[model samples]
Target: MTGPVVRKCPLCGKPRSAEHAPFCSTRCKDRDLMRWLDDGYALPGPPALDEEEGKA
Candidate 1:
């Protein structure tokens, strides 16, 4: 029989904790937050138009 599938933490590859869900601990969770706050993650999009260009 096969055992239940284990999910590893996205940050440290550690087993995920029920409390943290996707992360293994608060540290990893906080790190992921920091990455977001610091613009470490971004979505695909075209360049934004500048205010000057719109004014022209």
Candidate 2:
């Protein structure tokens, strides 16, 4: 099956067009940058659930 459609910019929920396939506009793209600078996004790690730890 074909992969899911590419997403638009997170800051502005708009369809990805040819001019800005990923981001609707430069402003939206920059907004994502601001979020990174402000540490607004975080990559969650997997929970530590080892079998050995449970045994203890």
| Highest TM-score scorer | 1
Tens digit of per-residue lDDT, candidate 2, span 1-56? 99888776656778766685578887777788899899898889987788988895
Q: How do the residues 1-56 of candidate 1 rate in per-residue lDDT, one tens digit apiece?
A: 99999999999999999999899999999999999999999999998899989885
Candidate models: Cα lDDT each:
0.97, 0.77
Q: Roughly what TM-score does model 2 have, to 2 decimal places?
A: 0.53
Best by lDDT: 1
Q: List the residue pairs that clash in candidate 2.
A: none
Please give the lDDT score at residue 45 for candidate 1.
Answer: 100
Residue 24 displacement (Å), model 1? 0.3
TM-scores vs. true structure, each candidate? 0.86, 0.53
lDDT value, residue 2 of candidate 1: 96
- Displacement of the residue 15 alpha carbon in candidate 1, Å: 0.2
Q: Stretches of candidate 1 above 4 Å error?
A: none
Error of 2 at 36 (Å): 0.5
